[model samples]
Target: MSKKLAVVTGATGGIGAEIAKQLAQNGWRCLLVGRNETALETLRKSLGEGHEIIVEDLQDERAMAAIAVRADALGGTALLVNNAGLNQMLPFENTPSSMILNQLCVNLVAPMRLTQALLAQLKRTHGTVVNIGSAFGAIGYPYQSIYCASKFGLRGFTEALSRELDGEVQVKYLAPRATDTKINDMKVRAMNEALGNKMDSPELVANEFMTLLNSSARRRAIGFPEKFFARLNGVFPELVDSAIIKQLKTIKSFLGTKESSL
Candidate 1:
């Protein structure tokens, strides 16, 4: 039989690359999907042989269909990590319509569509679908309006699909606190530092992801205060709103600048 395969989108990013490496080390062949062909080739080489690369932008519908076709042909697809995502840090009022649409498409729609396309293969192998969400998914932040909405949608989709496919496939959501990746720019980093927010490393997130794969838990949010606040916000959102209101000034100070996407 062919080896079990793991298709990981955004495989060129910090967290995504680490996830691919960890999966490869654990004996699961990886199909690294991202828009960067050069970086994908470099990552593929680092992971040794038996792995593959899918160089396509998640914003393209054809990319998702092509990925589904490739995964089906490869067979034994045991895992799909919907890790590709986009974020813009500007204030909602300052955010452009195009950026908002892009974020929603990449962070939410693409994952939903890709998972739907791969459902049959996943069911065949009783595979798992892990959506990489963010702390903002549960606790909305000041400058991340669109990003929060996208991630929140992803979390809801994962919950609904988990129940819908319960016995046939495993659906999980993993929320990581702000990680020290290129995704966060200098202004974003400064804001986090001013707010005393903890920024976890990509390695830490990858390790937590491995733990999630091994556990029976349906959802796991990483970090100390982040995990606490995600649950707290779920139960009492008003309280979270109050807390965020206090940090609004600091968050806005970084806003007026141009947004960056990774």
Candidate 2:
């Protein structure tokens, strides 16, 4: 019999690697996708057995098509973790046009297209699609405007897909709060520190993510207060506005730092 196959984007490191590790530990074969072949190979080897690797830039328009063909070669996929994402911290005015477009493409459009491309395989295998969104997506943080917009778009896409494919395939949206990864620049880290924001390590999140995947729940928000705030903001945007408005000074302090904004 064939092993249960899983495809994970952004699988070379950080949360994506951890998620893939946990899935493999639970007996799912992995197809790791990322931009670096060496990194993908490193992760594929670390995963032990029953795995493969695909080196492709998620920013490319052809990525969805390529990922679909790779999935076909695996027979089909049992799970699709759209874990690839771009995280940046910068003021709206400082963000370059090219950077803005790339952010949306990687964080929002890529997942949307990937899911569309893999819908047939997902339906046939009763597969699950896990979109890794952010608390920023729900609440729209001060410095990361474009990042927030992309996540918000992703959140909406996930919700619509869940409703559209409810019984045919399980679509889930998992929102994680500030995570400890290279994605966070030192300036961003300092702001989080100043604000006393909680940061979840990739391992801790991967563990919780696995639990969420096993349950019947269609969506979940990781981290308290962030989770609490996401729901609260949904019901009362004005209340959240009042709260976030107070953080402008702190957010501005980190804006001019020499950070990649990626």
Candidate 3:
């Protein structure tokens, strides 16, 4: 029997790495994509044989095309996990235009472009496209305006794409709440010191994501409180905004001073 091919972007990160590992364990020949050659090599070695690693920055359009070509050579792609993203906490006005562009490119554009590039192959296999979004996508957060915008765009894209590709492909948006990845260490510690809450663990988030992957659910939002708040915000916009504003006042106290411009 031929092995299934799965592609995961940002495969060096905590959640992405775990997803690649889990998928490989599930009998898929995983194609790990990331900018870090060292980390990718490390993960490739750990995953042992069938798995392949592609060291390419998703931000480069040509590189994404090359990824599609590589997957095609592997007997067509069966799954594409668009998990590459960037995030930073900064006041909206203070965020540089370049940073905003970079975030949009990595978080939104790359996924959309790569999906477009690989659509034919995925369709042939009746494959799935998993977009790793964030809870911030559902609701706006203070000091995360741009990040939220990118995620919101991603969610919107996923919803529309899921409907458009209803018959040909499975499209899913998995939104994970604040996870205890390296990205959140400092912020988590500060939040814990002030707001009395720490981020969730990456392993926990990864497990939730795997559950979503196994289920037929079109949208999966991790973290109960965030999910509830997202739903409430969707229904009661004004009330939710007011409540979030009040909550942000407290959360901001824990955010600490801006260390560097995002």
Which has the greatest lDDT?
Answer: 1
Model 2 misplaced stretches (Cα beyond 4 Å): 257-262
After superposition, candidate 1 runs with Cα above 4 Å error? 256-262
lDDT of each: 0.90, 0.88, 0.86
Better of 1 and 2 by lDDT: 1
Question: Among all windows of ten consecutive residues in candidate 2, which has the lowest summed lDDT?
Answer: 253-262
List the pairs of residues colliding in candidate 1.
none
By the lDDT metric, which is better: model 2 or model 3?
2
**Which residue runs does candidate 3 get wrong by more than 4 Å?**
254-262
Q: What range of 10 consecutive residues in model 3 has the weakest lDDT sum?
A: 253-262
Task: Give the per-residue lDDT digits (tens) of candidate 2, residues 76-127.
Answer: 9889999998877866777899999999999999999888898999999999
The estimated TM-scores of all candidates read 0.95, 0.95, 0.93
